[model samples]
Target: MTEFANPGVGTFAAWDYVVFASIFVISSGIGVFFAIKERKNASSRAFLVGGRQMVCGPVALSLTASFMSAVTVLGCPSEVYCHGASFILFCLAFSFVIIFTAEIFLPVFYRSGITSTYEYLELRFNRVVRVAATIIYILQTILYTGVVVYAPALALNQVTGFNLWGSVFATGIVCTFYCTLGGLKAVVWTDAFQMVVMLLGFLTVLIQGTIELGGRGNMWKIAWNGQRLNIFDFAVDPLRRHTFWTLTVGGTFTWLGIYGVNQSTIQRCISCKSERHAKIALYLNLLGLWVIIVCAVFSGLVMYAFYINCDPWTAGFISTSDQLMPYFVMEILGHLPGLPGLFVACAFSGTLSTVAASINALATVTYEDFVKQCFPNVSDKMSTWISKSLCIVFGIACTSMAVAASLMGGIIQAALSIHGMCGGPMLGLFSLGILFPSANWIGAIGGLAFGVTLSFWPAIGGFIYPASASKTLPLHLSTNGCLPLNISDLLSTQLLNFTSQERERSILAENWYSLSYLYYSPLGCLGSLITGLLISRISGPKHTTIVRPTLIRPVSDLFCFWTDKGRKDNKEKTPSDNDRIIRASAEKELNDVCIQESRKIPSIYIPEQCTHINVLCVKETYF
Candidate 1:
């Protein structure tokens, strides 16, 4: 066994284990309670979406906890420590994404009343398109959840001397059990409890660190003087990472894909009793996101303040900046007995909430989109059982992937790359369906395939041939207080040589790989959208039938104002009259196709007004 030089500073005591164990016990108990309560009604819908009766508050908190994850809790502080505060601008972009998601994406999914978000693809395009989108989402969630599971394990390993694999398996098995037993109800309630623990732990560190550092004023002064208070970097270079444009513009598309189109966020929203309540939950989620961001950022500032003089990196206490947060926690809270355990519990909670959410969402899309469609005769009880089994299977898969992820470098970048790789293509498919009525299944598939290929090329290349592009920040840190003169001289010389080495590559390779990871999602979305649109125009419109109004956003209709004057004049008609003309055209085409091809087209009733329509307004909804 590896021994710590100072047990109090680097190892967990008996009380610490007690506090951490209590969290697992309580979380598992909640699952048992819900499993017993809902045992009689074990339908697929109830298992997946909680019977559409989840309240606004807990669901909102659950969404927040899921999105925050261990990635945000641990990664954000490290980001601030290493890169500066430019990342805080993501909050603004996230707010815009929330508004867009609420007004555009949520209404469509909630109004359609679909079990899986990808079902909209089948309705708007084809079954092939739906399956393609579902596969992409599953791949993305698995890759991401693995990284989420690995983050806490890696951090705990550094401070608590616990085996990394032990942490990973413990977290994975516990999360899988509760999610499999109680389903979404257990996941949401446990997430709410975990969210509280997360906040309390963060606030505890912030308040305690501030006092130790002589109050907030001194902490801010020290951080600002050391050049760690980087807020707005207005640089306009796309290749330069973490600038204003990257965080705001690039971040908007990234977050839109995450919150707007991802099934995890959509599942929580649709679980609510009404669209109104879901909207309320979404807004509450925005508030929670901001709070979490602030806490993470401030924690970074606090870490900087505490280490302003005695730099941990130079002193050789830690190997990477990612380990800095846990190191700081153990250093400051070790003497307080259960405090270290509480902090570990907090990190574990983040990992658990996120992994549980992902596993549950993955099972949902798997069973609803694939298994049920493939095995149409499966009963509801059997289907629910399949979903539960799937939850366990995916949880195990994620745990295995977590072992692989441990060998990877930079948790934040790895997680975001995986998310962008899949999220972009999935978002593109939805955007094509909702924004462009002319897009066909051929175009959707082609676009997604091409987009995914482009996104993954850079990711795989970077992983295989990892190269560092930027220089480390020149923050104020001195070894005068912690290191002897001779050792300090050697350390400074080694750092100087490392920084001064030449990074040489061909111009083509440099440009290709130099594209900031932040732009990956936006590029993928744009590439897929443009490709789909072009292919659709080339292939001509396949669906001449009346497009469902709920599938089309009203904002997209505003493009009608910018059409050529001649076309607009010829098409001048009231909105209701325009709807009638479109319907008549669709009817004519349907009759002609039916006669020519000798095939029957399903008929459905629709309202004259778009605004008054709901899921009930149309029957035979799927083509």
Candidate 2:
């Protein structure tokens, strides 16, 4: 049996609501500003990619804000507090990973001049592979949307008794309204603003918590003495969670999946004014994300120091570990006017930024990949409107999904694992297309299918039958400080009600499924790579020169023989010296068609989409 201190250990004051509501007003106002200011820019390109003229600073901040969603603000602290500062390793891993991205993947993307990263897939493999990757990205984004929205709402519900579904809907609707109205620029600008507020809230808590704890030195001393600094563990065990190797090695694949091929990241990286600006944005983004990670983890350490003698779970202050941070806020900052509101607003800002970015990316992908593919000649106004409409639809759909998923109780907690299961395969598929020139469409498709299958089998099993981490992380907390409060009710026995009749389901998962979630990326990536290579050999390696060498990453051809321009493959069907022109294109002025059409057949091909040809002869005349 357990006794809770109260339903909500921290209640909001009168000014808290006002402070929280202001973030919504300003965010929505920015959307209105951009909607009216850029009303003339109605093309889908302008709307979705900001005409590729966006400044790097806000775009960089937006990139940081999007990934540092409510999950990072809330979950990372919980992670650090429970498992120690091992979460810091993820930030460091992402740093090196970003450098890899900038050096290897970023150059290829910028050179391609693509609206969607999926477009690269088509240029490299074919339409089928591109469409498959797009669908997977969309699915990954939607499942993740529920998590961002639901986390802040859950936090509010636990701390202030705010309505969970109400907050979820409000958060989703606000994100949709702005994302659909202002498009990419609005989302970026709004994210930049919200990021500042989030920093303010974090700083306030950190500074105030430190003041209460005496000083920074004391803050670290308490954390060190409490054994919450276990960050240097270099254990080589796969089953153990949060080891140095697991984080850096697995984290490499995870961040690679996120920054290399993710549509939202791709759009922001390329939306900058130039290659220099784009690279600068990514570097700045690295700094911003690293700051948030440090703040969140340090805040967790601060929270631990405050309740070191009286663990909140044992003291009955919070029902679950997730509530630790929010409850700590109430205990320390509850009395201060508008401070609680500021913190809540910070969480809300995080949720809105993440959700809005995903919604905008969803609309972008839909317009580029689906709508344009179906109706290529559609007018710009109609296409842009359709993109906006998609923003709304995706927004509402995500909100509803979040609400519906709430009914699943604790099962919704596994959503991250579910989303992560896709990361490995998606990363693998893209890496194959970029680094390995020998991979074909058959291999790409089959490899993706096989990679996802490999990831989910163990991921899902571990969720259902969670391995006890007790031996790995023995309870290092006590409630001795609360003994005088008379509120302690320990669960001395964890349900002896079995009466020896249930047989305890004597099965355990010590096999492959028991592998740590951190290794999911490596498993999927390795599986996809090996399987794709084997399958491609059967499909005859996509015929060397069919794809331009620029589509492949730099230096990739050094070891890859197929990507060399001089490769003569039997699969290529080249025409002889007397080969006739299979296709010709001529453009004359704005009409994009050659004049004198009646004279000598003009040699103009009126097609934006065409099949492979033996040779192309183009003629152009402007008058």
Cα deviation of 419, candidate 1, in Å: 1.2
TM-score per candidate: 0.88, 0.86
Model 2, global lDDT: 0.75
Q: Which stretches of candidate 2 lie over 4 Å from their true place?
A: 1-10, 404-416, 469-475, 483-492, 495-508, 542-545, 554-623
- lDDT by residue for model 1 over 309-408, one digit each (tens)? 6667556667667777888888898888899889888888889999999999999999989898899888879988999999999999888888777766
Clashing pairs in model 1, backbone N/Cα/C closer than 3 A: none
Q: Which regions of candidate 1 fall more than 4 Å away from where they truly are?
A: 1-10, 467-477, 486-503, 543-545, 558-607, 610-623
Per lDDT, the best of the predicted structures is 1
Candidate 1 yields a Cα-based lDDT of 0.78
lDDT of 1 at 531: 91
Q: Model 1: number of clashes?
A: 0
